[model samples]
Target: MKVSIFFKVLCVVSLIFLAGCTQGSAGTTVEDSVSLSMESETKVDETEKFNNDVDNNSEENGDNALKMLVNWKGLFYNPMVCSPYGCYEIMNRTDYTGNILYTDVVTRQRIFLSPDLSADHNNSSDPSWIDNTLGGCFLFTMDDTLFMSRYNYEDTPGELYCMDLDGRNRQSLVTFTDYNAPEGGIASDGQNLYMVLYKQDKQWLVRVHIDSGKIEPLKEMGGDAAFLTSAYGDTLVLKEIRAENTDSEDQMESYLSQIHTVYHYNITDGIETEILSWQQDKLLEEYSGEYLYLLDVDKESLKEVSLSTGEERMVIDALSAESINAEEIRSLYPIYDNHLIFDMGNDEGELKKMSVNLDNGRIFSIDPYTESLDAYGSQYLGIVGEFGDEFLVTSGTLEVPMDGIDPDGNPMVVDMVMSKLSVIKKEDFWNNRFDAMEPVEDVFLESMD
Candidate 1:
């Protein structure tokens, strides 16, 4: 609530400044002069000083310090759907014929394509439920072809469809009759597609050739499996049940209740590398290109492991334990320019971003808001999807100010303004253009709180 108040004041000042500059020559209004004076009076030299101190502190520590800027804002879309190559946005609105809309991020031009497949796989009683068919993970190949895994509850074997970028030629790659395809099953490497299938007793990770319908077992990890990360080139990371404890065995004595291990499988060589292991004592927070970062609850320290050498290092200790009363580490993610963003859970069970630090351990806080007081609890203000230098962040009570932007750009705000989607430029964030003044620091702080 305090953070919200700060944002409100900041917004009022910004609006007054913009109004005075625009209407000064037309007429000498008393309100305009007052607004200008108010803007000047609210300019806290201390705020700029604090920012300067942070910048200086970072520079003194290391030259590898990341320079961050908040550039543009728009609705956060899945990053995998964009970037490296390029991607088009697809929204499933419950209006009209339910067409798929595509837009180029660079040019901001809208490109319309015919619906490759109908949303109604099964003509259900509710039309809204029929539109659920559009929901699934999609990956575009280097050759500019779109591949998607569609789920059909009615049939035994669901479908994997491949279509031209413009939704032209369509073909079904493979259908699995024995095993149901998991959601977000397909991960591709331009040559082959990997799909995770959930069987009765064990989980199987299968690879299917894109060109041919040939399917083969990549690796079968016993127990439940959840998708974690993709190495982009050839490796896939999966979280699998390494060991399980049963009631027949001594449950109290056995330390291994449920251990989640991150395994890297090379699709090309068919090699499974046990890069990192997490037991009840240690937990993984996030992973970058070469490092797997974990939070040790028992030790109260942030740990990192090199994926190549299997060497572990303690980076930082959770010193401010009393101030936040954090019970567990909620979310750990990597930001652009190689910064680690971590969230900690408070006594109320709400999670907030605690710190943004580099691999070497220089830390900074972006606290601007108080944690929302709601019975249901607050959701994470995550950098859900990213592309190039930009990423999408969803925030607030209603997720009202959901926008995507490069945080390392000049002040430009792209106001989605409670619409289905809107674009905010870099200038808006820097200039404080929105009526809603959610400061970047405040956004981060609220997340941590």
Candidate 2:
């Protein structure tokens, strides 16, 4: 008998509890009379109110009360496609009038505003008029300011422009004479900006002072490579792939084409270390603490490695090896504190979550989303925002053309759909477990038969 795929019933249950606790207030305009000091006060007051509601509702609903903070209405993008700064939500893709937006994973509010290209450039012409594009990746935000890299194709010498998040202050930071910006370069620590440049089979890490637009080379990892993934905290974890090996390039038909590795680079010491390597596709995810979770191509197992010590532990292993294939590893997210949420596909291509135990090698089915797989497989999942007892879930799907127009002559019905933000309560998540199943003891155990 085919097993019934479990839906994230906890997410739905949490949503029910959150709906009761949240109290909506009137929207405040950006030009409100509140001073900067008063603005801080207002934010605190709003946060308190949100927290109070969550606390009260969670208490009433018992353990099932996970709070849903904000049900923000805006466009969403795949986090995987995002730059190190974060993902950008296309406000208007057809006419290309979108903004680079980020959601507070906890509060679910569209917190940071990206610089508006059309408004900043003052070019009412369609976005197609521009040769090189901007504003489709994560952004770095500090205080009232945000920064992102823009590609200026029309300029005599194509350059990467660093502009304010609001599209006000624009300046050229780096000039690329014979190259273009690679995806996943820009990262920020609220004070400094780090960017990566690829040229002539070499990768250079560039550091730019956000205040002065000053550029400096930090280090170079040898390869015609693109930044794969990054995590920020006390130390920075970056993953890059060596794209050009003559022999490997020739054998492109094989699944393992390049050397994929993760580099643990220290921000204070400017030292770098190669932490891990694999022959096939691998993924690295950093959690709240110093733990880094590595998931390989086959969904058969997962390894949790500590950054402090090079020690590694196998936290999960394949339950049904035949049922779990290499292509089924869809998406991964750090859930709560210790648990990890991952999605995998069955033979039918349906997605299912397998909650793996961090302390032990235990796995159980959790939930499923109805959306079909995109070219890259499962949709990117992220925490929108969290208040007290509530959290929000935001998801974006592929665009579909619409038939309508606004009062302005600009086409109103661009295909970009605002993310579907669902409110979830903390109480709904059940901290339970599946019946304990022994892992494959040893290869020789079954051979004894």
The residue-level lDDT of candidate 1 at 214 comes to 73
Give the backbone clash total of model 1. 29
Compare the candidates by TM-score and give the number of the best one. 2
* The 10-residue segment with the lowest total lDDT in model 1: 12-21
lDDT for each residue of candidate 1 in 260-347, tens digit (9 for 90 to 100): 7777776668888776566654565554534566766666677777655679886776635435332466655443334565666667
* Models, CA RMSD each: 15.1, 14.5
Which digits, one per residue and each the tens of the lDDT, describe model 2 over residues 142-190? 3344334343344444355554333445555556554445344344555
Worst 10 residues of 2 by lDDT: 436-445
- RMSD to native, candidate 1: 15.1
**What's the residue-level lDDT of 174 in candidate 1?**
71
